[model samples]
Target chain A: MDLSRISVVVRMRSARQAIDLGFVMACAWWKPLFLSWLIPSALLYFLLTVLFHHQSWVAIWGVWWFKPLLDRAPIYIAGQALFDVKTSPLQCVKALPQLYKSDCLPWLTWRRLSPSRSYDLPVTVLEKLKGKARQSRLRQLHRENANAAICLTMVCIHLEWLLTLGAVGLALLMIPEEINVASQAWFVPQEGPMLWVQSLLSYFAMAFVAPFYTMAGFALYLSRRIDLEGWDIEIRFRHLAAKQARKPAAGLAAACLICFFAGPSFFDPPVWAAEISAQNKGPKSGSASSRAPEYERVKKQILEILAGDDFHKPVMTQGWRLKKRDAENPNGAALPEWFIRFVEFLEQNNAGPNRIAAWFGRGARVLEFLMWSGLAFLTLYLLLRYREGLEAFARNAAAKKQQGHPPNRLFAPDVRPESLPEDVPTQVRRLWQRGAARPALSLLYRATLSKLMHIGDFVFHEGHTEGECLAIVKQSGEAALCDYTMRLTLLWQALAYGHHAPQSEAVEALLTQWEALFQHGQ
Target chain B: MSRIPLDTQYQVETPEGIDLEAALAGPVVRILAYAIDLILRSIVLTVLMIVLFFAGKTGMGLFLVLSFLLEWFYPVLFEVYAGGQTPGKKAMQIAVVNDDLTPICWSPALVRNLLRAADFFPFFYLGGLICMALGSKFQRLGDLAAGSLVIYREPPKAALSLPNRPPRSPQLSLSLEDQVAVIAFTQRHGQLSRARQQELAEILSDVLPCGSDQAVGHLQGIGIWLLGDRGETTSL
Candidate 1:
C-alpha cells in the first residue's frame, strides 16, 4: 500500500541520519590524545625520572608515552559525551536538509530542464531555520573560540617562561664553582691575585649564566614544537573530522631528529669532551699571556666597562653562596655555620675557598648585591622594550581571528524536520513539531550536561565513565545482542539531553556526530 | 605563551561535539612550561640563599625578616599577606597559596612564613624540589604541606572596542539601556573576577540573539572590534 511505502521511506531516512552521526563520533577521538596523552605523558616522564630515580631505565621508557594517552582521554571522553547526552524531536529538524539533498532530491537543481530555472527556496522555512541556525552557529563559534584561546594561552605561557624564566636559569647555571670556594679557610690559595677576579667571574656566571642558558634551551624547544604540532588544526578537526584527516600533516620530523640526535651529540659536554692531555691547547696557556701588565691593564679597562655587572644581580640557589665573609681575627673562633660547614666540606672534598678570601674582607657583599641590582634593572629595561613586540603580537592575533573562516567541517549539521508519527494524536504531533526554543537556556547548563551526567552517575551508582558504559553493555550479552546494545548506547549518549539545556549548534553537532557514528559503521 | 607557528588544531568529536585538541596536553608545550618554571625558581632561590648566607648570620636573619616583611602591603607591601612571594617567586609563576587552596591570608601568611623551617628539609631544598619535580600537580614541599597550588597570574588583556552587534530588533536604533548593557557586557571579562563574569553575564543575556552565547559573544565581539586591522582572533 502507499502508506506502507511512505513508512518505509521514513524509516530509511531515520536510519541514514543515524549512520551519519557515527562518522561524527569517530572524528571526536583526537581530544584524548591532547588532554590525556601529550601533557600527562610528559608529566609522567618527568615524574618517574625525578621521583622514582631508583626505577630502571626500561620502566622510565615504558611510562613515557602513557602520559600523552591518559592526558587526552578525559577530554576525548568528555567532548564525545557532550554530543551523546541530548536526544529529541529537534534532531529531526537538523537531519532534514541532508535527507532532502542526499535522499529525496539529490539532483533537484540539476533537473532544471529549462535554462531559466528559478532557484527560489521557501522563504518561510529558511526564515524559521535561520534564527535557530544563527543562534546555533554563534554558540559553536563561542565554544570553539574559547577553546582555541585557552590553547593559545598555554602556548604563550610556555613561550614566556622559556624566554624570561629560562633566561634567568641559564644565567645562573653559568656560575663556576670558584665563587663558592672563597669561604674555605685553608685551600685554593696557591696561585695569587688572578684567583680573586676568577672568583668574581664565577659568581657572576652562576648567578646569571645558568638561568640564561636554561631559558634559551626551553625557548628553543617551545618555538620548535609550536612549529611542528599545528595545534590550531587539531582544534578545528574536533568539529571537522574528515577535513582534518585530509589536511596535510604538520612537519615535525626534522626537529625531532635534531633534538634527539644531533642536539645532544654536538652539545653535550660529556660526549664531545676533548681530552686536555695537550697542555698547549688549554685556555690556561692564554692565562699566562693574559697576566702581562699591559694585558692586565687592557683587561681592567674592559672589566670596568663591562662591570655594567647588572647581569650578576640575583643568585641562582637560595643556598648558593657568594664568597663567605673573612673574619677580622684570622684565628677568630669559627662559630658560624657557613664558615664551619665550608671548612669541613672543602677539606673533605680537597678544595678551598681560601684563595678568594682576600677579596671578601671589605664590602664584598655590598658589591655583589649592587651587581645583582644592576643586572636585574637592566633585564627589566629590556623586557619593557620588548613589550612593543607584544603589542604587535596581540594585534596580529586579533587580525588572525577576524580573518578566519570556518572550514567545511564547521558547516551546520544535516538539517531536517522529523516526520511526525502517524499513529500519534494530532496535538501530540503538533506539540512535537512546535519546538520550545522559547525556554531560556543556561550556558552553565549547556556547557555542563555531560559533566552533570558523569557526576550524576558517579554520585548515583554507575562506577565507570559514559565511554566505558557501552563497553560494559557490550560485554554483558551475546555478541549480536551486545552490538545492538552498544549501538543504542551510542545513540543514547548522542541524544540524552538529560535534565540540562544546551545550545542548538551543540545539539546539532551531537545529532550530526551520532548520525556519523552509524554511517561510519564503527 | 605566544602563539607558535607550528601548532595545529584537529576537530575531535565527543558523543556530543566538544573541542579537545588540548585533549592530550601536548609534549613540548608542557615540558617547556615546567622547565621555565624550574629554572626561574631554582635560580631565584639559589640567589637568595647565596646572598643571605654570605651576608653573615645576622645578615641572613635580616634578609629572612626582610623577605617576610616584603610580602605584606602598601608603601612597600605590594605582595605580602595574600600573595606571599618574593619578586623572583612572583616572576617565576610560583606563589604561596594557603591551606584552603586559595591564596593565603595574612594570618596564614604569618604561620606559613614562620614555618618555612619545617618545610626546609635535609640539604638544600632536596625535599622541596623533589615534591615540585615529582608531584602530580607540581607542588613543592611547602605547597604540598600547605595544600596550595602555584598558578601563573597573567597580565591583563588589552582594551578593545566591542563588536557592532545591532541590539535584538525590529528596531535598528539602540535605546540607552541596551547600549549600556552591551558596554557592561563587553567590559566585564577584562575585570578577571568570577563576580564580574556573573554580573556582566546578567546585563547582556537579555539582548543577545542567543542567550547562551551572550557573555562570551559580547566580549569576543568586543575583542574583534578592538583588534582593528589585526583581524586576528584568539582561536580555541
Candidate 2:
C-alpha cells in the first residue's frame, strides 16, 4: 500500500519497457519466485505422471491445464516481493489459497486461454475485484497495454517451446553418433523412457518460463496503474509530507516571515516545515481565524512575484541569416580552422594553381618515399637481427621435404616415440615369460610399426589396415625389414582378431630379428 | 528497500565527471525488435525476387550476393549511421550503444552482428535468450563478445502545456522531489482522466489545503509555478 516502498522505480514506461522491468524484478527475486513456482508445479507433475502412467497424454494435458492455477504461486510471491514483503517459498505455498480464492473458477474454465491472463490476474488476486467491478477494471486497464500483454503471452509460449527443443537437440548431440536415436522418438514418445523424458523436459520448460511470464505481466499491471494513478507523484508527495511531519517547531514565525518576503532563497523547506507544524500544533503563535487573512495576503504576494519577469522571461527576436553561409560554417568547422584557412589560401591563389598543386604533389611524393624507405629499412634490420633463426628454419624445412608427418597412432596403437620403451625386445620377452602371450605379440607388432614409422621414416595413415601396413613395407623393398614386418603383422592379426595365441618359438624368432634389424642403431 | 533503484538502467561515469545513463533493454523487447527486423529482411528479399525475375541468370546471381550482404550487414549499417538504431530498433525505441554509452561505431556493430550466428546456436537464439535472461545487463553472446549493449533510447520530454492559470507557490516551501512530482502531474494532465488527476491531487491535501472542488486546479497552478510558468496576465 505504501507506494514509496514499492520495489520497482515508478515511471511512465512503454509496454515493452514495462515487460523488461518485470524481467529485472524476476531476476532480482529469482530464488523465491522460482522456488514458489517450481515446488508446487514439480509436485503436481510427478503426481499426474504416476497416476496416469499409461495415459501419458492425459498427464501432459493435466499439467498444461493446471498452468493457470500453478502460475498464481510465482505471481503471489512477486506481488508480495514488489511491496518489500519478506515471504519465504514455504510461506508463499501456505498462502496459495488466499491467492487463488477470488474468482478462481473463471480463470480455470472460461478464461483459461485468455491471452492476457497474467496481466488480468492481479485485478482478481491482489485487488480482490470480482464480477462487474472486475470486468470494468479490466476494461480500464486493458485500454492501452492490452497488445503488449498479448505479445508477452505469445513470446513466452514460443520461449518455452524453444527451450524444450533446444534441450532435446542438445541431448541428441551429446548421444554418440553410433547410437543415433531417431529424432521422432524424442518429439513423439507414446510411452516408456522417452515419453517420461519428453514430459519432464516440457514441464521444466514451462517452469523456467513461468517466473518471467508472471513477473512481466505483473509489471505491466503495475506500470498501467502507475500511468493511471500517478504512483510516482504520490510517492514523492508522501515523502515530502513525511519529511514535513518530522520537523520540530523550534523556529516558527521568523522562518515563515523570512521565507515569504525573501522569495525562493529563504524558502528552506525544513524551517518552513517547522513553522507549519508549529502553526498546526496550537494557538501558541496565533489563532487560525486571525492568521487566515494574513495567509491570504502572503499567498497573493507570492503568486504575484512568481508571475513577474524573473519567473517568465520570454524573448523573441526575428531576423534573417544567410542560410548557405550557415551551412558552410557548420561543414567548415569539421576541419581544423587553420586547415580550412590553408585550403582557402591555396584556392584563392588561382594564378599559380598548377605550381602550387605540383609543389603539394611533390611533398606527398617525398613523404610516401620516406615511409616506404623506412619500412624497407625496418624489414632489413629485422632480417639481419634474426638471420640465424631464418637459416635454421630453411634447413629444417629442406631436411624434412615431402615427408608426411609421422602419424601419432599406427591404426589403433600409439606409435609416438614417447609411447615406446627404450628396449622393445626386452619388454616383449618379459611379457611372453609371464604368459601374457597375446600382449607380448601385440607389443612386438606395435614396436615394429613404431620403428618403421619413426626410425625408418616410413609413412602410415590412421586408415591403414594390417595388410596395408605390410604392403607399404613390401613397396619399400627393404628385404629383411619388410620380411620381419610381414611376420609380425600376421602374428598380430591372428592373435588380435581370431583370438588365437601365437607360438612362443615364432614370437621369440621375431623378437630376435626385431632386435637385430631395429635395436642395433639405438 | 534496495539502496539503488532496481530498474534496468545502465550507468557509467566519464572522465569529465558526467554520469551517462541508458536503460538496458531486456530480451523481451530485443526479441520483438529482432522479429521486426526479420520480417523486414524477408520483405526485401521477396521484393527483390520479383524485381529481378525479368533479368535472368545475372539478376539471380546478383540477388544472391545482395541477400548475403543484407543478411549480415543490415544491422551494422543502420547501427553505425542511424544513431545506433536500425529501422526495427527505431520502431521499438531502442538502440545499440557501446559499453561506455557512446553511439555504436562500425567495428563494434560489425562484430556484434556477425557473431549473431554464434548467438543463434543449437537452435534459434535459445543460447542468446538464456544468456540475456541470466546476464546482469541482459547482454547476449554477441553483445558480451563485442562489449556492446542494447538500450532503450529515452524519448525527449514533452513540453508541459497545462492550462495558463496564474502561478501559485505552495503554502509551504516544496522540496526538489516535491517540485518534480508537481511538474510530472502537470505534464501528464492530458493523459490522465480528470477524476484520476483529482484523486492524485487529493493526496497532497495536507500541504495544499485546497478543498475537493479546487484541488486539481490548485496543484496544477503550483506545477505551473514550478515549471517557471508566469501568470496569463504577464505579457512577454
* TM-score leader: 2
Task: Provide the RMSD of all predictions against the true structure, rounded to 1 decimal.
Answer: 54.3, 27.5
Task: Judge candidate 1 at residue A108 and give its lDDT.
Answer: 34
Task: Quote model 2's TM-score.
Answer: 0.63
Please give the range of 10 consecutive residues that has the lowest summed lDDT in model 1 chain A: A4-13
Model 1: per-residue Cα lDDT over A299-406, one tens digit each = 565457546766357666666656644555665555776888877876787555674464464468889889999999999998899999989999999989977965
lDDT of 2 at A166: 88
Best candidate, DockQ-wise? Answer: 2
Candidate 2 chain A, which ten residues in sequence have the lowest lDDT sum? A249-258
**Alpha carbon deviation, residue B202, candidate 1 (Å):** 22
- lDDT against the true structure, each candidate: 0.36, 0.83
**Over 4 Å off in model 1, which ranges?**
A1-75, A78-522, B1-83, B92-107, B113-153, B164-236
